[model samples]
Target: MAYRKFRGTKLFTGKSWAPEDSVLITLPGGQVEAIVPASEAGEDIQAIEGILSPGFINAHCHLELSHMKSQIPPHTGMVPFLLRVMTNRQAAIETIQESIYLADQQMQKEGIVAVADICNTLHSLETKKSSPLQYHSFVEVSGFIGNTAQNRFDQGRAAWEKFREFGPASIVPHAPYSVSPELFRLINEFDPGCLLSMHNQESKAENDFFLTGQSALRDLYTAIGVNIGFFQPPQTTSLQAVLPYMNPANKLILVHNVLTSMDDLVCLEKHPVADTYFCVCPGANQYINQSMPPRFLLDDQVEKIVIGTDSLASNYQLSITEELKLLADFYPEIPMSHLLQWATMNGAMALNMDKKLGSFEKGKTPGVIALNNWQVTRLL
Candidate 1:
């Protein structure tokens, strides 16, 4: 039987670093066969110039918005960025399809083995079906008005069901500001065990709106011709306002905690939801707001912190290595091995794909990737 053996500058098993003398052995198709000392490995061992680790798991991405790349200007703040996305999302069907295809191909080449992708429409369904990367579709629902709650829930549920037929999919709220109390309640009750991903505290405007009911978010609603007069300020942070409606049985993934504060973290600790993952897309945050999530988000307070590329609309590219490199540059204090764990294992666990992806454990077929001086390439 032919097996592939690899030794790199360093070997990260997705969880931790392998021994210096370890040589990774894998079946021809990339399944983990063993991690043996160099003395025991045969003469066919391959050498790598940089770190070898399992393929990355992108815990949060907006694949449906891939067509909106570069259409929205940078450093425009969240409200303006969102307004532009709403205004320009519509395009020729071929254009949308082509962008999704290209984005999918880009992820595969960058060593993203699986993704927890946001889907507002079926535009990406065919591409995901044929792509080598694994995808868990998150059908995002949003309705700020109480009256439209049921309709929005129904529409999102219908889309989720179609995606479920194709692969793993879930119905999730788009964001705290965009989801009404009624809509949140409906989504929580839909599936107790479902994985819930929400756009949480990406901007100060979100908490400002929830606390005072008067913010740029209201202006955004007005621009779209939606009446938000019936809405009232909850006199609390957005996360606190929405936590009660979240089912404890669900594994919640909070994406883009750019403005998540200490108070919010305390509130989260008191909440019943035990499994919470904080997914940070620094590239998108920097592009839209010229800011990054507080360094504390990577501290001990956040037990699980995963990385994502967001989408072409807010990010320059879909590479997790770029995201990691950006993170390394921003927070030079954090170790690369620690960041790799977040990019791979934490992300895979957040998406509930850890058993099959993330680490280089025997019997797991986590695709092999080589990070040569921050340049990413798939080796298997």
Candidate 2:
């Protein structure tokens, strides 16, 4: 069997940096063969500059809204940005398809091997079917009104069923503020063991809407002709309010969390799920709210934190390396290894793809990539 041997730059095996003299050995097709000493690697060793690591895993993305890239202005608060997305997301089918295709291509070029992508429609189904990347589709359901819960779940179920026919898919709530208690119950019961992903605490308005009855999110509902007058303030943070409705057995990915506070983390510890991963989209958070998530709190409190690019709708590009660079720039105290683990191993674990895509374990086929000064080159 033909084999590939590489040495030179530091090797990040997705969990830690390998010894400087180690040679990464793999089959030509990118399957993990072994990591052995330079003397053991034998003849024809390939050399490269920069850190070589496992391909990136995007824990969260919105592929269906790729067409709205650059159409929504930046730094508008979350509610306004969401409202604009609602208005601008509608486009010709050809345009939407082309955008999804391009977005998938871009992520591939950026060395993303697997993605946990959000879907409200089947716009990305065909693209995903033919793409080389692995995907876990999150069919998002939203209905704040109690009476509309069933209808919303049914709509989301239709999409979920379609996506599951092709790959791993789940019916998940859109967010705490946009999903009613009844809807959450419906989603939990639909698939008791299914994984979940949710937009959480992306803005102060989201927390304010739950803490007090007044927030721009309420106004957003009203502007869209949805009366939320029947709702009452929970008098607590959004995550705490929604905790009671979630299934304790389900593993959950809480995305964004731009406004997630230390108080919220404490409350979460009191009532934890089976497994929880905190996914931060720094680019989207900066673009939408002009604010950063409390990374210090997340790093201190959370065990499994991951990174994402979100979508073109709310970000300049879909590159996990760029996201890591932004986080590294903002928090220089964070080691690059931690950020790489977040983008690789932790993200794969978030999407339940860790066994095959997170590390250099024998028999696993994690793709390889080289990063020099944050520029990515996909090797496999």
CA lDDT for candidate 2: 0.89
Per-residue lDDT tens digits for candidate 1, residues 43-141, read 988988899999999888888889888888899999999999888999998999999999999999999999999999999998988888899999999
Tens digits of per-residue lDDT for model 2 on 10-116? 89988899987888899989899999989888999889888989999999999999999889889988888988988888999999999999999999999999999
Clashing pairs in 1: none
TM-score of each: 0.98, 0.98
Off by over 4 Å in 2: none
In model 1, which regions exceed 4 Å deviation? 301-303
Query: What local distance difference test score does each model get?
Result: 0.90, 0.89
Best by lDDT: 1
